[model samples]
Every structure is written in structure tokens, then in C-alpha cells.
Target: MQAPELVERMLRGDRRAVARTISLVENAAPQLREIMAGLAPHTGRARIVGLTGSPGVGKSTSTNALVKALRARDESVAVLAVDPSSPFSGGALLGDRVRMQEHATDGGVFIRSMASRGHLGGLSWATPHALRVLDAAGFGVILVETVGVGQAEVDIARHADTTVVLCAPGMGDSVQAAKAGVLEIADIFVVNKADREGARVTARELRQMVGQVEHGPGEWKPPIVSTVAAKGEGIDELLGRLDEHHAHLTATGEADRRRFARAREEIEAIVMSTLRARLGDVHGHAALDKLADAVATGHGDPYSAADTLLAALDT
Candidate 1:
């Protein structure tokens, strides 16, 4: 398909266009560069909110409820649910959207499931590219949910205007926020399933963790909100806190600084990837193949051979 037609369809809010654009970005197809370049100006209008937490915290349920609420207010919403597939198999179990009841044909809301494609932090590297597409496509709100919790999913902080960390009671509640590096980035902390017992204790633990962190520039403290996502309880308060954090970011220019930094990092990675692609063409893969065989056989040191090959690539 021609690029212009595809872009036009995207502007029309065509679902196929959304999928196609994301695929183009994910594959890093050089041909889509021109299309994305034109689409860049349409981005930045959407407010991105990232929701994340450990397993079984009703994050998906909460996300669906929130999207439904916004849609009720006549807002256009887009949900990018990023899930990681098992490395052994090459498919995703991105089933979070299934719990989102009654919004399939709502027209005001768009929900698309995404696999991480093995990117670090359980987010595909092309995710920012997809975000740009959605931003340009004019979705008023975009929510990014990531909960792959071993290493502090800090990438969400880089992408979202406000980061929300969700927690629940009846578990190792005290360390929930602290252990995931979430205590640092969360602008708003939510103790979901708040109707359950131990809700107050969980909230207290999160508050203590937040208190220990050195107040960042502008020194606005993080607020903890309790919610029962299943029944839509406290969602308004959650949304209000989200807005407050966004206002703080805007008032202090922290938002712009973070966006600029994220753009720089993404652009640098793209440039290096392009350079590496150019390297293979210049070095000739067949010759490099023989060099690889030689190195494996102990006939040549991998470093010197790689240096020689890379030097040729510069030319």
C-alpha cells in the first residue's frame, strides 16, 4: 500500500491503519521512515498515563474501568496493552483487553494489545514510535500499562506524563512499592482492591516509602489514592491525582525536559541501529561468515577480526 493512503487512513482513525503503522515501526522497515517523518507533527496532543503493578492486582480491570469512564465523558481513548510472550514460544498472551466489558464497538475507545518483541523492561522498542502514531492520530488520552516487575520498569516513566503504581493488600505489602523502583517514579500510588482488609496498612506502607525518597525538584509530594477498581470506587480521586501530577510537570517544565531526554535517547538508538545495518552491507556478510568460522576454530582472535571488519565498514 502507498504511504500517503495509509497515513490518510490513520488520520481517519482506521483500525487497520493503526495496526499497520505500529507494524511498520516495530519492524523498523526503512520504507516507513518517510511516512513517520510526516506523522511526527501530529503527535504530542495526547496525554499519556502509564499504569503498572505486579500480577493479579486487577490492573487490567482498573484500566478497562478507567477507559470506560473517560469514554463516558466523550473523550477519545487509546489503550496500548504491552505484554511479553515467553521466549521459548514466539507469540503473546496479551489477554488483558478481554476483561474490558462493552467497549468493543464504543468508537470513542481504541484498545490494541502489543507484545514486547523481547525489548528490555517488557516494552517493545518501537512502542514510542507507536505512541507517536496514536498521538498524531488524535487520541485525547493514551494509557500504557507495564507490570513486568523484576527490574523497575522505569521505561514507563520515560514515556508517560504521569506514572501510576498499583498495589493491593494481603501480601508482602510494605515492600511492594520499594522493591520495584516504583517508589521513585510513581507520581500517584494506588492501593487498588481497597475494599479488602488491610487497605489502610498498604497505603501507609506506600506513604512511608515515598517519604523516604529525597523530594525531587519542585518538591511536590506523591499522593496515595485507594480504589476498588471492580466497582469504580475512588476512580475520580485517582484521575484527579493524575491531573495534579501532570499540572506539576507542566508548571515546572519537567514534562518538556523528560520528553526531550526521551526523544534524544530514542533517536540515538535509532541512529546506532541504522549504522549497524549499514555495517553489514559494507563488510559483506559472506566474508564476515568466513571470519566467524576462523575465529571459532581458534585461527583468529574475535576482537582483532571484528576490529578489521569494523574498520572496513567505516569506509
Candidate 2:
């Protein structure tokens, strides 16, 4: 079907159109550039918050809790939970949809699971397209949740208007948070299971870490919140903070700056993905396969392989 036709249907709030648009974006359709241009005008208006943590730190649970709280405030929320890409099949794990069962019947809440699909470091090339559909469809809040693995945690803050990093007791992630790159990206630190034995200790370490950072005058201090997401404990307080942060951004003229950064990152993701698609297998299969073999054999330099891809651009 034509891009305009699909876009018109999506503007009319057709569920099928919305799903179809998202599918096209996910697959990086050749016509996607045309589709996005049409949808651009309908974008913005959704508060995109990124929730991220290690796989077991209850990122999804907290996300569900936040969505519920937002709905209670009469806000329509869209949750896009992200999963890792499959190495062999390149498909998303899609566990978030199955886990967010309670919101299945709620029309006000739209939930979707996305995958990096080997688009590393929180790569969300199709996110702008998806968010555009939701924004046009009338969602007031958009939550992008990522499984905080590797250096991808930093990427979340880049996408979100306000980022909340989730950490729980017994995760041995205190220093790891400082090193995992989560600490730098978080505007707020959450000790997810406040009732746990070492919640306070975890909070203290985080607080100290935050204190050590030198900031310009009037910098917003990141607050450490404690919550038990399963029973909805502390959910209200967390939502309150989200509201406060959003308000601060708008009041201080920082919203424009934050949106600028988010836009750039989103555009970079799209451009990079599109370029990669246009040039399939950037590193020839043989070179990449051999590079993997070389790493295994400790004979070939991975850096040379990277240099090779750049050099190929000149060829």
C-alpha cells in the first residue's frame, strides 16, 4: 500500500494501520523515508521516559507500575519494552508483552516490545516511527524500557526526556552501576525493592557517587527512590518525581535542549540503520567470519577489521 494511504489510516487511529506502520519501520522498508516524512508533523506531544536496568532488576515490573500510575492520572501511556536481538535469528525476545498481562484489556494503555536486533547500545532505529504513531494516535506518555545490559544503559538517557535507572538490593550492582554506565545516565536512581535488607546501603552508595560529581550551580540533584513494584508500593512517589522532572524541564527551558538531543540520537539511529541496510554485510561475510575466527585463534586484530570497514568506504 501507498505511504500516504497508510499514514491517513494511522491518523484515523486505525489499529491495523498503526501495527502495519510499525511493521514497516521494524523491517526498515525501502519506503520508510517517505512514511517518516509524512508522520513527522504528527509527532511530539508524548512524554518519553526510559526505564533501564540489568535483566533481573525488575525493569518490566517497574515499567508496568509506572504505566498504571500514569493511567490513574488520566493519562494515556504507551510502553515500548526493548529486548535483545537474537544472534542467530536476529529476532526480538518479546518477553515484555507476555509479562505485561494486566494491561492487556486496557484500551488506554498501548504496550509493544522492541528489539535492538543486534543494533547494539540501545539501538532503537524504529522507535521514532513507533512513537510517532502513538503520538498521533493520542498517547500522552511514552515509556521506553530497556534491559540495561553492557554499555547500552547510557543510550537510554539519550532517548528519554527523563531517565530513571532501576537497581535493587542483592544485585551486587552498586559499584557496577557506577561502572556499568548507568550512574552517569540516570536523572533518578531507584532502589527497586525498598524492603530488601540492603536497600539503604545501596541508596547510600549511589548518593555518595552522585555527590562526588561536580556540577554547575543549580544542577538538579538526582533523587534516590525506593519501591516494591509488584504490589505498587512507592509507585505514586515515583510518578510524582516524573511529573516534577518534566515540569522542571519545561519551566527552565531545558525541554527544548533535551528534545534536541533526543532528536539527534533518534535521527542518527535511523540514518545508521538505513545506511547499514543499504549496504548489507558491511564487513563481507568472509572477513567478519574470519575476524571471529581470528579472535578465537588470537591471531588477527579486531581493530584491523574495523579499519577495513572504514577503508572500504573509500574504495
Best candidate, lDDT: 1
Candidate 2, which segments miss by more than 4 Å at Cα?
A: 85-94, 120-124, 273-315
lDDT per residue as tens, model 1, 267-315: 8767776666687778768878988899999999999888988888767
Summing lDDT over every window of 10 consecutive residues in candidate 1, give the lowest-scoring window.
85-94
Taken over the whole model, the C-alpha lDDT of each candidate is: 0.77, 0.76
Candidate 1: pairs in clash: none
For residue 203, model 2's alpha carbon misses the true position, in angstroms, by 1.6
TM-score of every model? 0.87, 0.83
Q: What is the lDDT of residue 34 in candidate 1?
A: 78
Candidate 1 vs. true structure, TM-score: 0.87
- Highest TM-score scorer: 1
